[model samples]
Target: MAIFHTSIKTFSRGKGQSAVAAAAYRGGLLLSDFVTGQQHDYRRRSGVVESFCLAPPDAPRWALDPRELWAVAEAAERRKDSTVAREFEVSLPHELSEEQRAHLAFVIADALVGRYGFAVQASIHAPGTPDGLNHHVHILATTRRIGSEGFGEKTRELDVGPSGKVQVQWIREMVAAATNAHLEAAGLTDTIDHRSLAEQARSAIERGDDLAAAALSREPTQHLGKHAAALAGKGVATDKASTNDQIAEENREHYDFLVRKAGLEGKPAPVPGHEPVKRGGRVFNAETAGLPGGLELRGVSGVRLQNLLLSSHGHTPEQAPISLAEKILDALRDVEEISRARADLAMEKIRDALRWAQRQLSSQGETSELRQWVTNAALQVRALKSLIISRARRLLNVKSATRLRHMAEQEWERFNADCPPGSTRYSRSEWTLRRGRRLSVLEKHTAELKAAQERASEGELNAIDADILAKAELLAGLPHPSVSALRIAEPKPVPPDDLGSTRSVPRGPTFH
Candidate 1:
């Protein structure tokens, strides 16, 4: 499958990130940052297929070298807050040959240079794996325009703003188009989409394929950073990586069940909550079995679903009670609705935060501390919204759930053992005064924000009204048509040279 993956990040000195270090790691080279007096050597790193740098036509020839280019970039900027470079990491399609992949990367790099005039150092990497997957590229782009003289001013248009968002969208679209063209040329059928999973899900729903929409709408797993990913690839499991593995396993099981259900396409619909017959074999409920078609059990309690499937093909006495496919389809529809609702809630929170932020920016002046606070608050709200959405998508692992249940059971046993005879332990109230205080604090903050916005609105209206009055007074003082004709008839047009001289035109009536 050709999966789409692209991420953009900045290499900034403020965040303690060095362009030289980033360049060395991606290009598999040895480089030393002169400004920071630190050395970065990744020559021993494996799986780097190809690496090269691209620059503008007028850029010096030496600028094509990664070490020289980044070192120059670092030395040019005196500010500690300077952004040295922007990096774009994209996963290349494994379906294409190494040559084709390299070509695709160059095309993207050329587009980046053409659009932003930033120098790009692109590297294609193919990690060695059992499946020989994980082909990807890293494109480190200078944050400034490269000229014949050297690096010019920073490309402020590519900073965080509307223009930057448009630039990102253009890059994503261009990559998708280029990848599709190459796939077509190679006579391959697979394609990749640059859109988010939620967007793809919405499109599937509009196309009337709810099943596909559900499949496409799974919550995305968290991205493991380079070090974590490398460790996990080497069979070392971090906490998040382990959670992702469990989720992947669960999804695979669900997908296989769906596939098995799909095989029984023409079968009759299964009765909901059907009980198993116990004459020769035990029958499992369609819903309880969590399978698309119901399974019949043969003289066994607590047998695994896989074992039941292997044993029942020849030995089962009665026809399978219900179609598992229909049940699975129903469950998918339900899950799809829940996922859509959650997505809608997340979007609503984001929209509200954006609206509030816009209002704060527009109403408050540049020097207002309140305005800055509002801006920070808006950012925090947006971050919280994202956290909420991500948390909502997280599925509870079966093993974790079972462990928690066992822990609770043990706690109950201990509590009963410790209880005195004929005495009872009353349940504690879940709500507390601390919770109330937090709620009150939140309410106070909301009230303060509302009052501030009201004051800003009044000030803006007053300023607008005063400006309107002044403009009206100025217009009232302007000469009438009759007076203007008299003035025009009295004066001759000034010559070109005299216009630059200290010559003055006849003055019109002035407003007080």
Candidate 2:
């Protein structure tokens, strides 16, 4: 499928990013960073199909060269922490030939230069080896406007302020249009969409296409980012990629159920609404599989019908035996159970670390990295729990799956009702992360209160004291009194234990 992917990230000194090094990696060049006094050489880098630099008309001649361009760009920023550039990543259709993909990239680049008036360093990368659908473009753009006189004022409109998201939406729409135009010109029927799956589903429903709406209503796959995609190309699985694969399997199983339900009801076409079955659900078309035209296959099961279906297509008997679907489901369930148990144990360790980190946060002068790590770990746990629930959903029928969630909510409520006082009335592992974040905020306010006490006038001190007291009560869930003397102990580093995995059992005739 021609997928739609557009993301814009910043090259900012505050985030430890350098435009020169980024350009080197994206364009596969060897460049010296004047700002950092380092040489970045990516000339030996492979898989870069094409790379070029774009300058706005009337820009200085020196702006045409990427190395000099980024040097000037970094020097132009006066702040110790300033945004050097912005990168726009756009995915190209693998259905298009290499030349076609390159052309599409150029069109998108030109549109961006005209819109933003920045020098664009664009690179077109070849599709990934394992899965060939990752063909994409990397466009590094200056954050400032440029013209005949060279770089001008910062493009504050593009910064994450009032108009930032609106500008991003315009870029997304423009990219989608340009991609579809090129696909149409190349005589390809497949077109990409910029809107989310839910939005697309709503549009389908408005157009009175229930089947298309139902298909579109399924949750889309999570993005396998650059690192994860590279890992996948090397045949290494990531938690994110594994979760996406499981979601895809569940979607297919649901679609297969719809097909069977339609067949059993003697409908001309499959719509939606049904109980999903096991994994490895493969759809066999009557025309393609050489079955009788309009033949219903709802009740066709067991070894005999399975063989007939596979024999018509000349598929290997091991490819998709009827029992293999159930076997794969059982295997997946086993993997899910094992994974959930491990994750729950890991969650306890994370909670303990979180509690320690929160206590240490007040004393550490340089805890930005630790704070970010804490946030990332919390989000990771949330995603892990979601994937586990999704696995359970895939194994059960519709009502059972829905009830599983409702029951979970009820159980959590009951837990809270039975929990002792001084608690947050929530799951401790989840509350641990929340409390850690709140502790950071409380410490900030406490410091502010002390600082204000030292320097503020009477009126200002009174207001500051009131705000601090409220903040301490709300943010820290602590009692009144003793706002200062907040020195805390340092946290010792303890490396996390790596997780192990159990592979899914392969399928063959076990004579089920």
Candidate 1 lowest-lDDT run of ten: 293-302
What lDDT score is found at residue 468 in candidate 2?
A: 35
lDDT on C-alpha atoms for all candidate structures: 0.59, 0.62
Query: Lowest lDDT 10-mer window, candidate 2?
Result: 293-302
Each prediction's RMSD over C-alphas, in Å, is: 32.2, 28.9
TM-score of each: 0.50, 0.52
* Candidate 1 lDDT, 134-164, residue by residue in tens: 7889999999999889988788877799988
**Where does candidate 1 stray beyond 4 Å?**
36-38, 128-130, 256-512
Check candidate 2 and list the clashing pairs: 58-148
Give candidate 2 misplaced runs (Cα > 4 Å). 261-512
